[model samples]
Target: MTETDVVVIGGGATGVGVARDLAMRGVDVVLCERGGLGAGTTGRSHGLLHSGARYATADPEGAAECIRESRVLRDIAGEAVERTGGLFVQLPDDDPAAFDARIEACRDVGVPTETLSADAARETEPELASDVRRAFRVPDGVIYPSRLVAATAESARQHGADVRPNAPVTDIVVTEGTVTAVETDAERIEADHVVNAGGAWAGRIAELAGVEVPMAPTMGVMVAVDVGGVDSVVNRCRPPDDGDIVVPHVDRVVLGTTSTPVEDPEEFSTDEAAVEAMLSEGAAMVPAVADADVVDVYWGVRPLYAGDDGGRGRDASRGFQVHDHDVARLTTVTGGKLTTYRLMAEAVSDAVCERLGVTEPCRTADAELPAGDAEKLDALVEEFDAAGPADTDIVG
Candidate 1:
C-alpha cells in the first residue's frame, strides 16, 4: 500500500540517476529493480568515461553530449572518475589523411585535443606500438561503476527516495487510460507517474502498459587482462569497430568490444572468436595488451533505439530518446550509454515535471554526489577495490 509521486523501473545507471534527480527536486520517488543494482547492461560496461573523441568524426551531436556530460561527471562524481585522460592512436594501416577530419570534428564539438607525434605518443605510453602513425590526446577518464551507482542510490535514499532492489515489477495497473499503480513481487505501489528506465528490459515494461517501443538490445564482449598495460584509455583512430578500445583500470586492463544484434537481451553468450578479436585488436593500440594474462571475459547489452536512420550494429546512433505516453501517464527513457546517464535522466525528469505541473529546474548538473571530501573519496575508493571481480556482475 505504498504511495509515491513516481516509480522508476530498472536499477541501472539511468534509473539510479533518475531517482537521485527527482528526489533532489522534492519529488516522492521509488525505484524498483528486478535484480540487484546495476545487474543489467550498466554493470557490463568497459568503464570508460568517454571524452567524445571517438564519435566526433561520425556523430558530432553524440560527441558534444559526451564532452559536456564528461565534465559534469568529473565535478559531481569525482570519487568514481579517475582523470587518466585518453588517446586516439592511428595505425600505419589507418588513413593518415582522415586524422585531419577527426581533429577538426573534435574541435568543432568543443572536445579539446592535442596532436602528438608517434615518438611523443610512445613517450607518453611506452607500451604503444612503434608503428603508430598519429596520436591525439583528449580528456577521457575511467569510471568505477559499483561505487558510482552505490553512492548515487545512497544519495537518493538520503533525500527520501525508496530504492527497492529484487522487487521485480510484474504489472502496471492502468485505470481509465492512466497508470494508477505498479505491482511488484512484494507489494503494490500506487504512483502518480512511472518512468521506464529499465535499459534492455524497457520495451517489455512498455508492453505491460499496452504500448510499443523499439528497443534494439545490442551485445558487446569485453575481456579483462590482469596487467595494467597503459595509464590512459587507448582507442583506435578509425571508425567504430570491434576491439578498438582499451581501458586501464586499477591492477587490470580491459579490452573491448564487439557489437552484434540480439533478439533477447538476456540471451547472449561470449565465444572464443569474440574474445580473440578483442585481445588481438586491442593489442594493435597497446602492444602489451596481447601478452597480458586474461582474468575475465564478459559481455554487456546496450539499449539502442531503432530509429529510421536504418543503421544497424555499430552504425546505430548512440543518442537517447524520451517517449511520453500521455494517456498512460508513463514515460520511457532508453538508449545512450553510461557516460551520459545523468543527461538522460534529466531529460526524462523534465518530461515528468511538465506532466505533473512542477516547475523545479533540474539541479543534477550543479549538484555533486555526496562524496567531495578527501576522506570520503578515499573511503569510496577502498570500497570499490574491495568489491573485486565478484561484484563486477552487479555493475551492468
Candidate 2:
C-alpha cells in the first residue's frame, strides 16, 4: 500500500485542479481516475468561458463568479482560451425589457456590455439573420477543456503529485469513522485526506465512504458543425434553454445544447432527434447554421443536487457546495460551472489544508499554467486541418 497525505478521486477539472493546488502547497497528493483525464463533463461542455452575461438576469451571484474567474482563467491559460468575446442577440418576438435588465445586471457585476443595432450586429457577424432586433457584446471567450485538464495535470506533476489514469477507486477504506485508504483495482493507497471531485460519479464515491451525496445527474448534448458560421460566441438573450448558445472553437463552431434529465450519467446516448433539435434551435440564432454541415455529436452529464422542489439539472442553482466530512477526513466539492473551476479548487484545497492544520494561503488565482510548446501546438493543428475531415482530433 502506498501512503500519501491526500488522495483525490476524479480526473476531471475539479479533481485535477484540487490535486494541482494541494501539491503546489507542498502536500503529497495522488489523483486516481477511472478513465482518461477529462473523459467526463469537463471535455463535453460547450467550451465557452462564461462572461457572466448568460446568468446576469436569473442568477446574479453565479454570473458574478463567472466574470471574475473568466479574467483569471484567460490570464493563466492563454493557450487554451480564445478571447473572441460574445454576442447576446434578441429576436423580433424576444422581449427588449428583459434584455435591458440583463444589460443592467451585467453592468452591476462589472462585466462590460454594449448594445448594438441590427445593422451593427450584422457588421460584426455577417451571418446573423436580418431580423435581429437587439444585440450586445460582452467579454466572453472559448476554453479548450482537454488542454485545460492536461495543463492542470502537468502542473500537478511539476509539483510532485502522482496522477494515475484508468485507475478507478473501487472502495474507500474506513476504520471507526476515519478514512484510512482508497482501494483501486491496481493498488491500495492510504491517505490522511480524501476529496471526491468526481463530476457525475460523485455520489457513488461518497457512498463508498459510507456517506450519501444527493446528486441528480442530467445529460447535455452538443453538436459541432464544419461551417465557420460565426466568429464570436452567440447566446440567446433569454432564459437557459436548449441550443441557445453557439461557441466557436478553433476551426469550427460548436452548437449546443440539449438539457434532458437522465437517470444514469454514463448510459445516455446522443440520438438523431437531439441533433435535429439542436440544429433547428441553433439556426434561429444564426440562419446560416441551418445549412451547416454537421461534423460530430457528444454528450455531457451535469451532477446537480436534488432540491426541495425536485428541480434537476439546469433548473438547480449553478452554485457549488462543499461538504466536509470531518469524522471521515473526507471532503466533497460538487456543482458550479466550468468557468469557475479554479475558484472551486481553491475552496476545496483550503478546506483540506485546514483539516490537516496547514496554514498556506492559495495562490492558484495568480499562478500561470505552463503552456504547450508553440511548435507542437501548431503542428497538431496543421495535422488536424490537413486530415481532410474537420471531425478529426482537433479538439484533443
Candidate 3:
C-alpha cells in the first residue's frame, strides 16, 4: 500500500508537472501512468512551441498565455527547444481579408509580428513557394516532447515524488462522497486528493469517481517528411483547418494536421488521404516538401472540454478546464496546448492546494529545469518507454 498527499493520474507533461510543482511545495505526490510518460497526447504533439499567433484571432487571452509560456519554456528548457521562429504565410488562394484580420488580432493581443514581403519571406526561407503572397514572422519554435516530458519527470523524482510508470489506475475509490484512495494494478494508493490528468481519457478517469468530464475528443494526424532547409515553423494564414502547420526538426519537417471529432479517443480511424493532403498543402508553403520522403506519421487526440453547446473539432476550446467532482477530493484538469502545460499544472495545483489548505505558490515558471546531454536525456526517455511516435526520430 502506498500513501501520499496527492495522487496524480497520467504521466504526461502536465501530470509530471503537477507532481513536481506539488512536491516542490512540500506536498507528497505520486504520479501514476498506464503506459510510459508522454505516451499519450504530450508525446504525439506536432512539437510547435506556439507564439500564440495561431489563436490570436479567435482567442487573444489564450494566445497571450501561449506567448508568455513559450518564452518561459525557452528559459527553463533551452536544450530541449529549437529556437526556430514561426511564419504564418499567406498563399495565393488564401483569403486576403483573413490575412489582414490575423495581423490586426495579433497586434491587438501584443503578439509581436513583422509582415514580410514575398521577396523578404523567400530570403528567410528560400524553399518557400515562389508564388508566396506574403508572410508574418512570429516567435513560434519547436519543443521535443519526449525530452521535455523526461526532463519534467526527472524533476518530479528529484523532488521526492513517486513517479511510477506502467501503473494503470484501475479504479478511484470514492467512499461516502470523498475520494479516499486510488486503486492501481500493483497497489492501493491512499491519497488525500486525486487529480485526473488523463488528457483525452480524462472523461473515463472521472467516470471512475462518479463524475462527468465532458470531453469531446478530436483526432488529428501528423506526417513528418525527410526534407530540410525549413528553418522555422510555418502555418497557413487562414481559419483552422486540415493540412496546415509545418514543424521543423533537425533532420526532417513534420506536416500536419486534420481535426475530426471522435467519440472514443482510444478507438478511432485515421484517413490516409489526410497524409497526402498534408504533403500537398505543405508544398504550398515550402516547395521542397512536395517530393520529400515521409519519415514518420502519428495520430493524436485532443482533450477538448466540450461545454453545453458542444463546440466540436477546431471550434472546441483549446483552453484548460478544472473540474471539481461531487466527491470531496477529486479534481480533473484537461485541455490546453503543450506550450502551456506548465501553466495548466499551476492552475491544477492551485485548486488542489486551495482545497488541501496548502498556501505555497507555484515555482515551476522560473525554476531552472534540470537536463543533460543527449545521451542522458535519451536514457530518461528510454527508462519510461516514452519515445513518443512523433519524437521517434529525435529521442532515441
Candidate 4:
C-alpha cells in the first residue's frame, strides 16, 4: 500500500490549491480527482476575478476576503488573469438608493470604485446599452479557469505533490473513528490524513467515512455568446438577480446565472426560461447580446454550506467552512468562491499542517505560480483534459 502524509479528494481549484500550498510547505500530499482537473465547480464558473464589490454590501467580511485574494491572484497568476476592470451599471428602472449604498459599502470593504456618468460609461464601453443611466468601475477582471488550474496543479507537482486526474476516489477506510486510507480507482493510498475538498461532493465524501457534512448545493447556468465591442465585465448595480452579470472574454461574454437549490448536485436540471432570461436580461445591460450568436451553455453547482442556509438558495452565504469530521484525521472544506480559492487552500493546509505538527506559514499568496507560459499552461491543460465549457474555445 502506498502511503502519503495527506490525501486530497477533488481536483478542482480548492483541492489543487490545497495540494500546492501543502506541498510548497514541505508536506507530502496526494491529490485525486474523479474527472479531469477543473471539470467541477472551478472550471464551470463564469471566471470572474471579483473585486468584492458584488458582495460588499451584503457580506462585508467575505467581500473583504475577495478583494484581498483578488490582488494576490493578479500578482501571482500572471498571464492567467486579464485586468479588464468591471462596471456596475444602474438602469433607469433600478434603485438609486441601492447604487449609493453600493458605493458606501465598497468604500467600507476597501473595494475601490469610480462612478462614471452615462456618456462617460458609454464612451468607455460603446456596447453598453444606451439607456444605462450611470456606472461604477471596480478592479474586477477575468480568470482562465482551466489555465489557472493547470498552473496550480503544475505548481503542486513541482513542489512534490502527486496530483492525479481521472482517479476517482472509490472509498475511504476508517478504523475506529479515524480515517486510515483512501481507495481510488487507480490504487489504494494509505494516508495519515484525508481532506475532503470535494466541492459540491463534500457531503458524499464525508459519508464514505461514516461522517455527515450538510451541503446545500445550488445549480446556476452560464451562457457564453460570441459578441463584439464589450471590453469590461458588466454587473447590474442592484441586488443580485438572474442574469445580473456579463463577464467578457476575448470574443464572447459569459452571461450568468440563476441560483436554485438542488437535492443532488449531480442530478439537477436546467430551465429553458432561465436560459432565455439570460439573453433577455443580459441584453438589457449590454444590448448587443440580443442577437449575438450563442457559443456555449454550461452549469455549475454551488458548494454551499447547509448550516448557513437562509431559506432561499440565493440567501445562502457564500462563505466557506472547514469541517473536522468526527472521524479523526478527516477535514472537509465547503462553500467558497473561485476568486478566493487560494485563501481557502491556505486555510485547509494550515489545518492539515497543524495536525501534522508542521509549522510552515503559507507563502502561496506571495510566490508566483508556474504556467505563466501560455504554451506550457495549455499543454498541462490538454494533458489533464482540463478544458471545460467556460474556456472550451481557448484551449483544445
Each model's lDDT? 0.84, 0.83, 0.90, 0.92
Clashing pairs in 4: none
For model 4, residues 175-271, the per-residue Cα lDDT tens digits are: 9888999998867999999999999999999999998888889999999998977889999998889899999988899999999899998987788
Candidate 1 structure lDDT: 0.84
User: In candidate 4, which residue ranges exceed 4 Å CA deviation?
Assistant: 308-312
What lDDT tens digits, residue by residue, belong to model 2 across residues 44-74?
7888899999988888898999999999998
Query: Judged by lDDT against the true structure, how good is candidate 3?
Result: 0.90
**RMSD, one per candidate, in order:** 2.8, 3.2, 1.0, 1.0
Predicted structure with the largest lDDT when compared to the true one: 4
Better of 3 and 4 by lDDT: 4
**Pairs that collide, model 1:** 40-396, 42-396, 43-395, 43-396, 44-396
On residues 1-396, what C-alpha lDDT tens digit does candidate 3 reach at each position?
A: 988999999998899999999988989999999999998999888989999999998999999999999999999985667889989999989999999999999998878999999899989989889988999999999999989998898888888999999999999998999999999999999999999999999999999998899998999899999998889999999998888899988779999888899999989888889889999998888888988998888999988989877899988999988888778999999899999999999999999999899998999988867765777888988887778877788776
Model 2 reaches what TM-score against the true structure?
A: 0.94
Tell how far residue 285 is off in model 2, in angstroms. 1.3
TM-score of each: 0.94, 0.94, 0.98, 0.98
